[model samples]
Target: MLRSLHLRAISPEAKKVGLAAFLSATAFAAVLGITAPAQAPVERSVAAPAAASPDSVELQLLGVNDLHGRLESPKAVRRETGGAPVDIGGVAALDAHLDRAERSHPGRTIRVHAGDMVGASPLLSSRFHDEPTVRAMNLMDFDVGTLGNHEFDEGGRELTRLLRGGQRSDGGQFKRDAAGRKANTSAPDFEGVDFPYIAANTVDREGRLGLPPTRVIERAGVKVGFIGVTTTATPNHVLDEYTERFEWLDISDTVNRQASELRRRGVEAIVVLAHSGAYDVNGDPGAAAGEIIDEAREMTGAVDVVIAGHTHSRLNTRVANSDGLGDKLVVEANSYGAAFDRVRLTLDLRSGDVTAKSADTPTTWNDEVAPDPAVAALVARYRAALGGMGERTVGRLAEGLERAGSLSEVAARAQRRLANADVAFVEGGNSRGSLAEGMVTYDELFEASSYEHQVMRMEMTGAGVRRVLEQQWEAEPDAPLHVAGPDEAALDDDATYVVAANALLMDQDQFTAFREYGRGVRPVGTDLEALEGWISSRGRETGVGG
Candidate 1:
């Protein structure tokens, strides 16, 4: 679709400006066209960027976020043309696209990530505890990356190992053994990092040093400063154990400090890679907190660009600083490698300021571009390496659930099968991706229940169930919490109920105090034996059990 549109829009001569630019502009326009109809009643038109000043360093920033270790192409997210059945993900393909841009304009490209690079990882990265993902980023030479909330999934200690990169967390060293070397001798140590991962908002309450705040990359004789920030609401998605040792600071303050330091260091152009999100100007159903844009505008000093992620919402707008400092360009590439983000920041070398720029988010259609051979090779290597691991099935799929059905339906069915509740309460995260046709494997099952949610069952009356559901719907958009419900329906409290949930969800803020089942407690399985027995009494069914 993108290629055809490109062919129709410009001639081959225009390709010299770089495919990233052409594809980005075209994809942005196409997405706007597609979403406009859905957003009717409220019409939105893309505003043209202001005129570029004569002097400025032309910086092309390409970014991706929430990759979640999707090294190969993802399965079709939706059946429609909204997502592709063909593979559009893979580091090789991404590398290929990057190469194309570089070939047109070599050494002028700055590739970045907005975080969530590791956890909920696919087989390739997960088998090695996200080491492969980190290694791939190193190979791709990421200039600097911000920390996403998922980075803490394995706890801060594991993340520190990856960041330092001295040795692989999988127990392998970067060095090789010599035939005559002593078995007890250690391998030569690897230099800590070839790149930097920054988390300005992340602080070590114990150690007192936070993740690197910013990096200065000299490209085309211009030094670009980048500030990084993790989400402030990270605890909502991560385990308490990992975050217990650290303190999360205000994002705006982090930005202010980093930007000031960068300017003090004589870096001219600045970009903020915030693991935050954008929202509609108004707080409607579609509008989320545009944290990246807001923070950039609010931060004092010379900041030119903001690349955002985490909410997975696509954005294309230039919000002027709320304090009347200046305009900050904010661009977000949609999640899952579904799109490519390109920000063209032109800087004036003489004045060390941005004079003119344009940034865009372009769809990455598998059908439109061939996968980069190198990236493909890397993905293929991982696929083959983990082939047996990925193929191993953990459970049978007898339930015939279609992705088209409501998310509630799938969650309810899972709850019914797992807990034998007359009415099951399902949380929103219960469903993130769709199950494809044919047998559902362990991979599919894990994807459905990826968060470390344990099997939690609590007995409750039908009326109690309805009340719990009411609490689920009342979750405020800003103060988003987990699903709410009593963990153990107390017989003494006048209701006997059985609820099954993951440990991760059980400890969530939303459900923690639901009807007074305090933190980290679950109903004893022995107590729910009767309910399990009743479920067993009925013949076992398969497939989502619906």
Candidate 2:
């Protein structure tokens, strides 16, 4: 018998508003049925449908961000979730969840994603140019998705192909288009997704072509509008070359304009899917919720809800809109399908504006719900297709290595080899998991360096380097892993040394590279790139559990 956990459910009023926001025509289906799985079906709790009245509508937004190529369940993760864990993500499971939500709620539910759906994909997708991941997303019923930085990793044209859906070099897994007509097997999965890819902030320099300004979904009888905006700070953190063709706009301004237009069109509700982080003026998590409200208060009339990402935060705060008409909910689901944000907004059927709301993060307990057999079957197919590649060993370790504590040592060794500095340093958190004294495969390497990191070398002064070390060891002993700046200037701003880091970590404003160094900074080299080249040149051989 499959059991289900009762996650969070919204008030009936909120569902009405949510449904009102999505429906464009006067058609609605209110079929009362089980919204979630039965009790104790699996380890993780499946999300339940929002309860609502006949006049009220239910809109369920299923969001996922930063799923960086975790196509298979790692041994460690599998253990963490429990042996029969609910297999939280994967494309098929996502489909089951979607189908269950819609079926239970009938006409009120709609699916929407936050972003980071592609790029950094595993062998299955990356080997094929990340099209598989997009294909799976389309089948899973992604109504709309924003342009995450990874989507641009391959640049504009490639991303356009992915969105447009086309052929691949080595044929494809299936031969069907969105219209259910036989097509090329190599085609991507953008079929049947009639929704637009929105990026209100991303613009071509000439302003003629850019990501669709916004995507509108008409559900039930209400017209719901969604404006997608990724972080403008993206360029500051990501490789700028990929995004250079477009100009990232300000969230507040673009969303305000789009919301006004939506309201003008009789859209009952407005939502902003902002791939930006919530920060205080000082750029710290401790920043008050009021500070975030103020930062976004400009959209009182234009937008009703804001869904944030990038910081990988879980926000469930409610604040009154600048208009004081009602509260605007700011929500976010943590990455890796770990959880989801359920925001219920009550809309005045006559005014088409939100009246009341409540929001919360519903933890997805994989154990509580059964892994949809169809999804599990798809995973099996992909796993079988990959055949042995998933577990093939890339190299063998000479000896057993410590799990968490030894990361600093491994990083130090790599840094000395590549940078040849007095001391090599890396964040303890970056090197997750221990290296077992056995065959290490591609999967193991990915697990160890799963952050999609790039190696960045820079010159740091002797003084600056010493300061960084002290900060790492002393400033936050309790939180020893997270490095912070010291109060006094113990190092010279001009002295320099060679330091290696990933491109993702090299960005200053986002990761504070400049702030960490007192002065004299220049690129040196990267460790991972060197490792990849060395391995490839050696024509590395892999093995099994031997």
Candidate 3:
């Protein structure tokens, strides 16, 4: 059953009217068994009974962030007792972990995502436009989610379609059933998302949110309100044309305003699901905190909990609210379903307020736990749809290609040649994985460059090249840009040269010098296809498998 909550503006003032109207139409939808009012009133009854007890009730919140459509577990990095890397994460294993957590918490548990549940997905899910991920979430019973920058990768229309459910623009269909069996006919229509996606800061040209701003969940006589928001820097990450109609408001102001409205409606226990996070350093989650901390500080004492993402860091610690609201719970689970934030809130039964809270981020290892059969079936269905593309031999490697060595140089050279430019630059991070020895498949190639980045050829002066290289030090310190063709020996300060790079690097604000100094910007092929052709050609030349 579809369930949702709509929170209208608390005041009718001119300034707040727009936010109120927007929120009233866009609030959390109950994907679980919980029910919420379609529209909440400004004032709510808060009278306590004479028999109100001093005892507290505990609520468990299990959350994941930056899932990024990892329907199956990726290669493991941590070793098991048997000296093998532990195979951890994937919807099935995650479902098992959730089951264990739910069984421990019983009726007091709720599941949530902090954003980036989709986008930059592997071919298994992205090939089908991330419908499988949504389906998996539905089976897992996610209560609520927020938008991430990646969710807007394909623009508002596609995102809207994913949330609303229907046939794809291309009228594609699932090729297999949930049990992994090939279907005799086309699969059913996409059912969209079962849960509501909330984003308080993202508003349309009409000042309306794309989804609900807040969602209230009541269970066992306790009510908790959640306000969801994406980072203000969303536009900087996504394509401009996709987000042209939307504006991001100040996160702190939006949360504070929404908290006020929720409080007036008798919601004293509040949580903020922000798609922004701080890095954990020296065992402190707030160490070198980012925008989420700023928003939490500005929230004063109105907000009690903050679940964050985007940085993909695993942290669980408390940050004191500026308004003397005690310590606010701030937590973030690592990305790609690797870990989850398990938070427990102790609520005062009499005051209807959260008295204390604590949280932990645990790895979702599949070593000991059996995969959830249903989720496994779902993943298999999508995996089957990948057909032979995943296994088709692309080339063979005599040895693994390291992200920072000759392999990267080779890739850059290939990109440069594909764009017919003097040099090409590829970020170290963009090389998601390395090419293993022996046969290399299309899947491995994709794993190396996971993003749907297109190649762009542009002209830049030698000075601009040096500036872009220098900018790398801003983050990676000694990290060098893998350049092909023009070595340091061939450097010319004022000479103009043609270069190629992934669209993200070319368009990023950090590399604005590329555009400011660049001329004759033209699109080449996608990074994947170019790399494929390059690898194929290399295989023929080297007499390797192709």
Candidate 4:
């Protein structure tokens, strides 16, 4: 049996006058997936439908975001309402959940995502440029999606190809892995997404919108409008060259204009899928606070509901619009497909506006439900394609390396060697797992250096290098690494020396010192490759990381 752990639900009603402000709250019957007095969402199982009145049509949005290409189970767990441990989040489980929604609602259900469907993903998915994740979304029949900062990790050229289909970035077909076995050989053939990806605020070098600002689709005799906007802070999240050709516009202003245009086209029921999210300060959904709240509050009544992403926090409360009425329903499903928001919208036929709306966030519980076989098979094929790369021996550790303090030090040593620099400065939290003693596999090493950050070399004076170390304290004053390099005793202020760091750290705002005096900066290779090289050369023939 499959079950979804119900986390939160809130029903919102807006005033008929503005037809947009959340006027009051009412109790809504939300399907909690388990113990709901209805059928659980198992494979081939259908949920009970939301009843519709004569003058109204009921629709459902299976809102998902930040999947991050989790085709295989991430093996993560979350506490249920009463602090009981519950398994959650796998592509197959998510697929099964979507199937249940469609089986119940049929044509009335719309599968939608709010961006970050790919990028920064697991090895199985990221290995193939996230094609598997896109294929899964296509199989799940996602109707629409938007862009998150991760989408721009490689810049617009690659992003356009991912969205529209083209030759692989390496310009080679995924015919076989290194082991000479068939790989990613599924239907749809890595062509592109079956649905549309919208982004209103992202503009290209040619001074045109990157994607359609709004998409209107007819459902149950009512036309629902969707507006997609990327966060304005996206540039800071990605590399400079990739996003230099594009510009991020004002989020709230762009949404208001797009919503007004949608209204002109008779789309009174509008949903803004903003790639921006709120931060939940407390357990209460209403108590959440973030920039998205400010943006929603500034929005006009033309917008009814806002779906947020990016921060990956759970939000299911309504915030006040510019009219000083709590009329807007803002919701965000937790990231990595661990959970999703079931948005039930009721629209008035005559007014063409949403009369009532509510949301239920159900965590994907693998133990309670069977994995969708279709997606399960797809995952199997990809895992087979992953070959033995994951299990291949990378090196042997000298001892169990500690997290945080020790991990960065080891990675820093690798960076120094890979870039052939005098010192290597790496950020903490790069790897969530610690290296244990003895034989280390590529998977273990990859997990320790999973961000895929490129190693970069910078030419700087010894004085400038000291400034970089000082900058570390600015952020972590309590206990800073301080980083004593081999050349510390004989350091000269005016003499230039080569320094290395993760590329993101070199270019990010926090390390302005790194970008200021660093000259002849260039990427060496990926952080994982550096770690692998360093690890393999250190201990036995296999290596010395601790």
Candidate 5:
């Protein structure tokens, strides 16, 4: 479906000339000569940009977000193209899509990443510490990106190693022999990103800025300042062990501080590359609501556009800012390299402010172009490295598990069996993939639970176990807290029980209740390892998958 959003009111305003220009996604749909109804609608038009003059020049921003280290393609159907099933993801296809988009407007396009470039990934990338993903990003040439919650999954030190080249902490191409000499091995290739990843809201333990807040880029004599930030709710979602060493600043305050400084340095057009994300409410793109929406609306007038991610949803529309200067365009592509954004902005060469702007969201349809051969080869090499991985059937699922809750339940059960504990809990951390019905392989299990978190065995009384179960409901009404144990009715308050859970929960604030009763906490194998053991055992006994 080729379509564009056309608005009826709000032209150029004088205040916008020296001030700010806010707008949304309405112009790109028209590029294909298609009119669509799902786009965000304003009270007429959502644009607040200045009228175009001869001094105005066009600038483009190509954006992507929440890739999650998908080095290979995922089987997804493109909604815009009549729901035809095809391979739409993978670094190879994304490289192709980005290449084609950039060529259309040579020298005026900036490839942007909204965050989550790694973590919560498939076996091919996660096993190699996401080296393939970073290498692929460098190949595509991203201009600027921000930090997402998942990026901190392995802790701040490892993330630093990813951004700034350093020694591979774990398995890699070389190993130290008896003489401490480099030994050759078939390990992953590791390196840092070639682009700048900003983190305006991320702070160190001392409340000091951790990463560069903003970066200014000049195209066609027009300079646009980009501010990068993740949602402040990051600490809540990440491992407590990792988050304890860091602090999260407020999103709006962080952006304003950086935006103000950028303006003082003579930057007029400020674009925020935020890790925050939002969705079109009720299937209406214009009616977006989420943490990203709240941040967008609260942004000062100095900001122009917001490239957002994290919720892994679509948002192509204009929003009114708190400064009341005008509406600003907010765009987000879906996750796993599935889609991207092409935002066209009319920059006034005189004031350096965006005069007019419009954007469109396009799916990374590999069928549209020949996949980038280099990236495809890179993905192929990694797949071959894990020879016979697909054939190693761990267990069989009678039916596929599609939701995170189902997979979480599997994790919980595996941990219980591994620890021979009375129960196990699955909470916190991100669940990346789902299990398909049929014979489950080690490859599939890695995809199902990718987080590298150690499992902890805990001793708790039945009363405390009951309390934790109640706490799950207390936190969120009807929130599914994965637990593997005896029947609820059989759980006696006075009896003692052993619990298995991710090591992360012991430090997380939300699960602090566990600390109140947790005793004799000891480290068990990792969550993935437990699952592997459980599946292998089941696969051997049943001969019919789990």
Candidate 6:
């Protein structure tokens, strides 16, 4: 039988140790295709139904979070019944899952996305400004969603255009044909989002919500209110310019206020679709904790369920609301469209209140489910538009390189070579993934350095460089800045040196030292092109793996 692990929040040290153990245990279960003998089922309390009768309604909530424009299936691991590593998470696979659920529940099901639907996407979708993803979501019939930090990557203006389609900010039109070629038309048609995007806590300069604060869906005489909220720390994650016009209100305050409004409107069964989540170490959702937990506890009597994302952690557990409205279900599906939260809510139709709810996260394994034909066709079109560039082999790696190690080194080398600077620096987070062994494709390389950052050359004193390196530790104690072309033994504190970095590192206020110390900043090439050129130029000489 499939068994669940009990997850609970532990100290950072304990987390690191526990994470290893958890991975090992899950991997063993996956490899054997059986539950570990020592593993125990997660315990959860189910509330008694509120006077069951013909008036009661059952609502099935199917939702995904942090898809990040994964139109294609990425690599994933499954442990439910000891499955081998599987290719998981494509729009088509997600569609299949949704299809099965909807067919089972029929009209009683509502498909919702938590957030991070776009931004930091693969080239296939990002190249088209994530229009393909929006189109895909529409095809999937997503009911509603909120925003995540990545949604603000390009700023509110672009976000507005995404929701209410029109010409891009630059007034350029780009409409692709079936073959993925841009049509020879002056104006490209862009379809706006069919479903509403709720942002209860995200307000404009005038302190008014830019989108609907909440949405009420009534079905079978039952009313359910969904309050959408993004993380309050959105500004810290996104470029300052993108968020200058907006304000992120307190999550708890916003949810409570919106819940009150929803209640006053004679709607109960309140759910908060928050783009923030707690970390679940085990299967116990309550055991996982984060900023969302405090926010959920604060909602107490107002909120019944919380569907969370952002942390990209799996959580299918419950937490008691401090205000004493019974236990509230909180859940998060792992990111990249790898999985989705399946929640069933039993509601009292007369009171329009949720009597009980249960949730679980199931992996969207591509091999197990046939692709949805329509979504598959849509993805194929976009893939063709990419023109096989992503698949072009750049070079070969003798061995796989971890994101922090070889990937970082390769990026630093590329910047140094492109800018001819004495020192090159790359933030750890900037390198998104690892480099696998064997033939590396442009797409694979792009995955490692996905951002469209422009190579920037700046002159900084050695002291400034050290300060910048030190800053990495200030924010993330464990993640140190990756540097190339700098020799500590030969370094001079007062000496001035040319440095190469991405524009994000140069302009962001958080890297004040880099900004203040940088001189003669100029863009050379995009990070993607530079990495590609660098790898291609290497041409298997010296081998990247070595």
Model 6: per-residue Cα lDDT over 1-546, one tens digit each = 000111313212123235676455334434433322243233223233334478787888889999988888878676557867778888877876776665545567778888999988887877788888887787677778998988888877778878887657553345344354774322156676778899988888854336888898866668789999999978766767778889889999988888888888998889889999889766555588788988887884768888999998998878887856588899999898898988889988778888878888878776656665445655766675566767878887777778867777888888888898898987777777788877888778867777777889889888888777767667633446678876766778899999998877665555777786888888888777677777777747766622
Q: Supply the TM-score for candidate 4.
A: 0.81
The per-model lDDT (C-alpha) reads 0.59, 0.54, 0.74, 0.74, 0.74, 0.76
Tens-digit lDDT string for candidate 1 (1-546)? 122122324422123235676455445444433111232232123233344445544667888888887776665444376654655556655654554454433556688889987787754566555666665565565777878998887677667776775544434322112222322211133233347787777888777344667878888778888888887888878767778887678888878888888888888688888888876456341233556666666776577878888877677777677677667777777676776677877777776677776777766545444544323434554455543545644444344344335433555444555555443444555444665545445455444434434446665554555455455546565222232233434223445555555445545666643446422335423212222222233313444333
Model 3 CA deviation exceeding 4 Å by range: 1-54, 77-82, 170-188, 206-209, 283-288, 402-410, 460-480, 488-496, 539-546
- Each prediction's TM-score versus the true structure: 0.73, 0.67, 0.81, 0.81, 0.84, 0.84
Q: Write the per-residue lDDT of candidate 3 for residues 72-187, one digit (tens) a residue.
A: 89768665476768777998788767766665566777788899999888777776778889878876778888898889887777788788887666333433433346433323
**What lDDT would candidate 2 get against the real structure?**
0.54
Worst 10 residues of 5 by lDDT: 1-10
Residue-pair clashes per prediction, in order, are: 33, 37, 3, 10, 12, 3
What TM-score quantifies how close candidate 6 is to the native fold?
A: 0.84
Residue 252, candidate 2: Cα error in Å is 1.3
* Candidate 1 vs 2: which has more TM-score: 1
Error of 1 at 54 (Å): 9.0
What RMSD does each model have against the real structure? 11.3, 11.2, 11.2, 10.4, 11.3, 11.6
Clashing pairs in 6: 7-282, 30-82, 33-82
